[model samples]
Target chain A: MQQSNAPWRTPALIIVAGCLIALLTFGVRAGFGLFLEPMSQDQGWGREVFAFAIALQNLLWGLGQPFAGALADRYGSGRVLALGGLFYGLGVWLMAHAATPWQLQLSAGVLVGLGLAGASFAIALAAMSRAVSEERRSWVLGIGTAAGSLGQFLMVPLGQAFLAAYGWSTALTLLGCGVLLVIPLAGVLKGRAVAGGATSATTREQTLGEALREASGHGGYWYLTSGFFVCGFHVAFIATHLPAYLVDNGIAASTAAWALALVGLFNVIGSYSAGVLGGRYSKKYLLSSLYLTRAVVIAVFVLAPLSTVSVYLFAAAMGLLWLSTVPLTSGLVAQIFGPRYMATLFGIVFLSHQLGAFLGVWLGGYLFDNTGSYALVWWISVALGITSAILHWPIDERRVPRLANAAP
Target chain B: MTGHRHAALLLLAVLAAWSLLLGLALWQLRLNDEQAGKVVVLFPPAWDAQTHFERTLRAGGLVVGQAPLANLWVVYSEQAGFVGRLKDQGAWIAFQPAPFAIVTLGGCFSGPGALPPSFLKTRRLSGDRP
Candidate 1:
């Protein structure tokens, strides 16, 4: 097989394209919370209603990621992203017009979630990895993750401004329009699938059963799955409930928005730093340290004085720690198993994250409705964070001995 | 081999670009920080509130100060409409009615049957016990 002209150019272009796609997908999704109160109030619905929908969206997103990744690995990422963009656009539009809770759930939860699975980092990273050298994969993965973080930062402020200017409904419609921007970028990923004689000779070489069997049989995969669950729990819990918690605590809405924004802003640093550090250190240890730090941070935050300064301090500190795990965790999977089936393996691990996400997002609202406070949820997060730290600590990061000895 | 090297250089270029953009954003935030002002308002306790008031104050470019001798602390805003939770109090209330009025309710703060509708707007601040 002959290499393409400008080999590095194509890979770098692919990563950039992946970044753009990630930016659009996550950017819009992060601002879903800003719509919660307004949408609930307008429909005379409960916070649980909105929370449930978002939770479903998160679960579905998680469920879809690996499958999307698998499809991209077999078929092509460009098509997956293109289709995802369409579904994202349609889902956001449907959400804007949704009058019933079920309708909201269907639009925001199922459609948007599935859409994200296709266009998200799972697919993007896989595509980028195929284009780059093995040695640069971790750093490239970091760049891609940071791109999503950048999207969160840029889009949160943009979403806020849109909400302030156009109301939630119109804002969502505009965001849907922005999601369509991915359609064009998808073109870049076309015809870039890595070709292998072995892959083509055996149509069953990369079957879903094969991928599942490979991951399930591996001890490292379980650790990745368990550790990822904690990430989902922490992110979903914070994203879904932080604003309301701030409002409930007598903090102003603007400050809450900034808190959320700061989370994204600081994560830019955290994610990049994690990427760089992961390149230098053991990725698993870095992940363990991040989770432990998150546990410690949450404990200090809840126990400390409730002031604007303290909250901002907490946001900045946590933000720096947030999402840093993504590059490391994803990089480790690619390192241990290789990128051939990375999307599928990573997707399954992400499923655990989403399950945690499902519980975190749903339980936060449920407990709030039941007990009228976020205390239970915060305690749960602390426990989960500590547990995640423990889980990652024992993960064997060495390559699978079986795969290492197999014919190349 | 040469192609791989060029690819490596290109990847580095993209990384540099992304880092620069992030750095610019952080710099902009720092500049904005220097211009921010402090606003003070009284928050009543009784309402079981979270960080809403403080979040809103920060969003409005005001620094939330510590509680004064009275039960109320200074919010960065001079506006009367903002609501917040009182420190160590159980209920939430607005900041503008009167600072001295809130201080008078000190011991009875957040006690059942004592809070009026005004207090309902403000919840108790987290970690604050009355």
Candidate 2:
């Protein structure tokens, strides 16, 4: 890992700032579902209209990740993050005034999605990795990732209370104000990645073209990318639809909020634990096990009773497994290719995740509207979990030969 | 070294504060879950929830006041379980029942259409002197 000696760019400051960015960005994205029923009811729109808009948001976010990532890799993440924060706040504020689906598509879908691409874990983790030692790398990554869950734990309940007290419009505007904090912190994240040519103890200088071409040709990269799709599918479906699913199953609306909060709370532990384990274990195997465990957890939850106790238990179980995949997946990229091109490489992988998210959220609403059940998408999530489990098992974890030369 | 330590301390302090707020929020939600049964209910002008849900209300609560033209009734339930029982039997549920269930997001609320003039008599927190 490489970093300048600026006081503000120290590992401690980077970790603190990076974690906050991840917390705010990922946290807000996770609770958009709590607004679904209220917003739909207020506008007299069916679930499909809101679901499709969120689906577009997911798709656009995924679409934006690669470009945002490339730019961050070329320049620094500070400006990208600031710009992303501005757009994010703008998007949230616009969502408050949107009367039609088209307005929602522009604000909630396009702008928020694009903004998320800039400030998300993909960039923050990549940048933070450059500030720490290789030995502390995976653990640091986990810390940064866990902050997202912490944010969710903090934000979802607040969102519920706001939506319940004020209308969705006012709640959205307040949340928008919350996002504006990210702009200044982006400056705190000002640090450059050490290119491959820079003399670092264990890093090599690889040009953008070289890194992209190398990654494009690697079979393991494809496997890693493809496997991440299930993660997106599972997370988006649960986040966007779980509140309504709880309401449908005779649980209170607050239970939905509490359930999501439970997922967020437990996820902090899960992500950090996964990080610690990733540092000691093979990332590929850890990923495979995580995916398999998710399939089993979801299957068990489906078979169990839907009472509040059972729902809390399921949220705890799923939360432990939820975004736990993030560290392992990103760590695998750094492990195999080296951290030099991690932002760009991981961004591509995240794109696949977002594509899966699009299908999961849109299809969740579509299927529910047509069939009056989310059972089909639930099954799809289970099947894809198994598929990703199998996909990760064979990914080669060895560093690329060209970049394998000793860092010094 | 002290500067780094101070930075770390500040981060920890911020995190602790956020955790406190978050814990309090969750604690508040769980605590308020029981207290939200306090509400103003208005049935159809000619109808009554107390008389209609008489057996359930008698077992669980007391009707504090009534306004016939407003089609409104203030039912103060000392029992927190009162609302849950009403919800269990699929009784009408509303966020603000006096102004005619303006925002019923959960449970059964008949339908979502314009409330009749008889049910639209709005009230303050101190409603129906009867």
Off by over 4 Å in 2: A36-49, A99-101, A163-170, A196-205, A240-258, A303-310, A363-379, B1-16, B19-130
| Model 1 lDDT tens row, A1-408 | 111224434765677788778767876776676677678889999877987887677667877888888887767778888888888888998999999999998998889888888888777877776666666777777777877877666565455446554677987898898898888888776643544433333322446677578778878789888988888778767755666677667776556656766777788778767877887799988998899999998888888867799779988888888778888998898777666667777877777877876677678879877877888889888998889888888888876654454426
Identify the candidate with maximal lDDT: 2
| Candidate 2 C-alpha lDDT tens digits along A1-408 | 564447756777777888888877766665576677678778888866776776677677778888888888777777788888899889989988889988888998889878888887788898877777666778878877777767666565456556655567987887888787788877877755764343354444567788899998989999999998888788778866666676666665556656766776788888888887888899999999999988988877776766899889988888898878988899889888877778889999988887777677678879877777778778888899999999999998987776566643
Give the distance in Å from residue B40's predicted Cα in candidate 1 to where it truly belongs.
19
lDDT of model 1 at position A56? 74
lDDT of 2 by residue, B16-90 (tens): 866775444333333222443555543444655545457336536555654232445555666766655544544
> TM-score for every candidate vs. truth?
0.71, 0.74
